[model samples]
Target: MTDTITEFDSILEALHQAIEKSDSAAAIRTLQQADHDQTAKLIDRLSVEDRQALFGLLTPEQGAEVLERVYYFQGADIIEELSAQVAAPFVAELDSDDRADLMNELDQADSEAILEELDEDLAHETRRFMAYPDGTAGAIMYSEFVSFQADMTVEEILNDIQTNRKKYIEFGVQYAYVLGREHQLLGVLPVRNLLFASRSQQASEIMIPKPTTVHADDTIEQLEDIFEEHNYLGLPVINKDGCLIGIIDRESTTEALQEAATEDLLKFQGLMGKEELRSMPLKVRSGRRLSWLSINVVLNLISASVIAMHQDTLEAVIALAVFLPIISDMSGCSGNQAVAVSMRELSLELISPKEFRRVFFKESSVGLINGACLGLLIGSLAWLWKGNAMLGLVVGTALALNTTVAVCVGGLVPLALKACRQDPALASGPILTTVTDMCGFMLILGLASLCLPYLV
Candidate 1:
């Protein structure tokens, strides 16, 4: 990872200098030395005119290769800048799944125009792949899987594979689907298995019958579960009528899951919808961020209102004011730990939304043990610092109570969101912090108010 970052930084610096000089040839030379992913990263840093200039320096095939390495939204932005005549051929050369993804990111009119420019057959195939709902297994699966009839002899299948070696290589063939009548999926034959089989053996005799399968409409989460349980290189995707439609390769599944995880991380950090080019206009980036930040402002005000309610208590015992942030911030940290665990459990399907009660009790137990230990330690320090027993008790008790509440709220909120068909990580940081702050303030100040005479 460190090496990759260093390489990216080096490439980015070189590209910046070349673009600054308006040296398209130098830029092209630098880009040619970099791989597709490196090129994609550099392209994102380029100004719109520079990006166009860079693309002009490459042939359509080189442009397509770099575009393929870029994320869907970034690729769409780049494609939109090109003329239809220039963009269409590039789009047509993309893998079917990638082409569909890019088109989906584009506006309907733009997508249609580009589709028209593609060859009739390629356009039809791209449209079919795009027909699946976003986030389903079908949407991400490749349609280039190799299949053989169950009755085909091993020799015959081998001959066909050798004949279309390039196509199989492009498809990343890991397994061959065995089909019955009407192209119904009968079994799966791993390529490794075929190598050991006799030349005279039939596919049906060697194939693994009733292989685990997923429907086209199955959610990516469901696909994740299947992938976790089985170590197959690819899983056959079937339609409602039980005929094979496509195959979901393990690499694609891994990539989708990783992207989902990254997205969740971004949403957790309140950075939603900001996955765009760094060269994106400042106003657009600010707008995307401000939507979430603005919502957070209102949410945080609720925590502030709690402090306002106890203004008198704060003024009487300024030390309590000093500890307010410490208590709240510490509890918030603990709560985030619980949130991380719950999010992982939810994503991995280790627990269901309905299992919230079980997770609640488990996290609460953890909170109780951790809170008691932390509370005692902080309470003793308060006594030594202020020489006030009541102040010690108030701060310590408040910390303990707030810690328990924080863990419970943290664990439950994500599950609650999942239950409501929402992203579990959506604004979770602000929501969790708000609740922890409000609860911590109420506990510390309310206690201080009751013992004001002793504190003073």
Candidate 2:
């Protein structure tokens, strides 16, 4: 392991030097020694100047390979810096799936400029997949899988695949899709079946009938469920009229799931919208971040208003101030847990928006037990700190009720937003934070005000 790490470090050092010097031949030589993934990581570590230099030095084929393997947003940043003529060849060299993914990440003007430079057929193919909305089956599927007519013999199909071995491998040709006269999916013929069956037999005679397929507009969540439920190697993507358009292999499904997960994680932390990279323009990055923070400022004021309303009660009992953050922070943590669960279930399609009652039942039961324990813990601390029973009771009761409300709100809010077609991941956090703060303040203050004489 030490020797391997040392070798990689040396390669990294050498690559950096070559790139810094703008020596194309030396950089290319260093790149040849490192694999695509290693080169991608190295590229990410370079300064913007060096990155552009290295990118320009790579051949279009090498550029396509790195772009296909690197993070999609980073690839977009690299392409965004290059001219249309310079980026076009690399975009064209990518597989149909990768071409669409890269184009989807780029700015509209840049994508259009690059698209114009591609050959007619390749450009049309890229546009066909790109036309689908993001996260749909059409967006993730490859256009290169092999297909044959029902009347074709096994020998004919085998001959074609053999004649075009490079294309078959490039397109991920595993099972030969059987199609009707109109390109409607009829069935699938496994490669093994084709190899073993009599060469003279027609494809329809040996194919597996009515293979599983997804519509072009279907969700990635649905694709994930089907992939898990069926454990199939690939699924056919069809249009509304049941005509097969392309094939989504297991790799594509897995990649889509990962991208969705990363996307949701970013949104959970208020980084909603397009994925951001450090290499992006300062104005654009700061602008995207502030868009959410600006809304957060408003939501925060609303939470703060609750405290302003109960200022008199707070002044009479200053000790209560110490526990304000404890209750809110603890409740926020509980609410976030509920949010995580709901987001997970939503991604898995395990729960629906209308099934609020089921989620409520589960979250509330957890809330009750957890709330009671948390209340007792904080209440004991309050009594310990002030040696007062009333202080303990007020804070404890407020915490208990606040926790219960927080979990319920957290659990149900995502469902409500999702049902209304809002982004549950992006909207859930601010809503949960504001609710936990306001409710924690209201419950603590309201209870303390009623018992202010004893608390003092």
Candidate 3:
């Protein structure tokens, strides 16, 4: 990845120098040859003046191609920088889905201005896409799918495809949808199948009926399952009334899943919402993190209070304080492992929230076995070091109990959150840490309090 980025950076630098020297032909030639993703990255790295100058150099159609492939945020930034008239042509040339996404990211006034400039059909299609709730199949699907009547013969379909090869390619046509009256999807015919079928056979005879489909309202997670289960190039998205609306290609579905994974990871780290660029204002960057940090401070105080309640015990045996963190840290590690397993199962839909009891029992059994082994090993070491069997027993028993509790909490918390329709990852670390710390400290200190006479 580093090498690829570095190579692109060199190409961008060459393009920049060409632009600076008033060599429009060379600049356009360099831009034209650049890979779509690489061009987007290079454009993002250029200075504002240079970026705008480069955009000015490309034809509106070429500009649209680049914008369609760029990250939506970066494309939005570029659109915002251009005058409405200048941006409209490029927006007009974009694929309906890409145009809609770009419009959704733009300011209302700017989006409206661009909409006014678009031809009526494209503008209407853009509105249709913008209307779907974000993160749904409808929101991400492309509206340019190829559809044919069920009665069309293979020869007819071939002739149609040959006549509009450019249009079909532009739509990324792979499997042609067989539609009935009122645009209701009936079946699907792969291009390869069409090529081999008898020329006189009707599409209805060749196409696969009742192909797997997704509803427009289905979430990205649901779409991910469909893609994983079926090895198809694209899946047709239908409306509640059973009419085909759009097509979600495998590439788009994969991208959505990847982006969702990245977002979840950031959320796990307490970075809420989209990632902020370093160039963003200081206040914005700090503001994004401040709320989560404040919540963590309150949660940490809960663990502090547990420690405070055991102050007398700690004062009696200073060594108890030495093991407090060790006990907490080790149990916390165990808890986190359980959390990761639970989250993965939930994401993969291998387990439902309602099956929490089943998950709990299975995780608890494993925890018990591991906890016993770890406790025995650590307990023997403590006895050897302190020459106090009771002290070792206290530490071992506390660790074992704490580990079991940690595993249960870690496994169940995510499911509980899912049952409540909350993000399982939200503040998971703080919640898990607080529980394990409080349990570990209470177990160790409370047991020590009872065994104080024996220790001295």
- Compare the candidates by TM-score and give the number of the best one: 2
lDDT of 1 by residue, 111-198 (tens): 9999899899998989999999866898898788889999999999999989999878987777888999899999989888899999
Tens digits of per-residue lDDT for model 2 on 1-456?
999788788888998888778787887788778776776677677777777788788889877877876788888888988899999988988888888999988889999999999998888889888999877888898877889999999889889888988877877567888999999999999988998999999999999999998888888878887888887999998888888888887778788888888888899888857897776678989999999999999999998999999999999999989999999999999988998899888866799999999999999999998999999999998999899999998999899989988999999999999999999989999999999999999999999989988988
Task: Supply the global lDDT for candidate 1.
Answer: 0.85
Give the Cα error of residue 270 in candidate 1, in Å. 1.2
Colliding residue pairs in candidate 1: none
Point to the candidate with the largest lDDT. 2
* Best-first order by lDDT: 2, 1, 3
* Number of the candidate with higher lDDT, 1 or 2: 2
TM-score of 2: 0.90
> How should the candidates be ordered by TM-score, best one leading?
2, 1, 3
Tell me the TM-score of each prediction against the true structure.
Answer: 0.86, 0.90, 0.84
Model 2 CA lDDT for position 153: 91
> Candidates 1 and 2: which is better by TM-score?
2
Question: Which regions of candidate 3 are displaced past 4 Å?
Answer: 1-9, 18-27, 32-37, 47-53, 76-89, 99-124, 130-136, 153-156, 196-202, 219-230, 279-281, 348-356, 454-456
Off by over 4 Å in 2: 1-6, 20-26, 279-284, 348-369
Residue pairs with backbone atoms closer than 3 Å in model 2 (clashes):
none
Q: Weakest 10 consecutive residues, lDDT, candidate 3?
A: 272-281
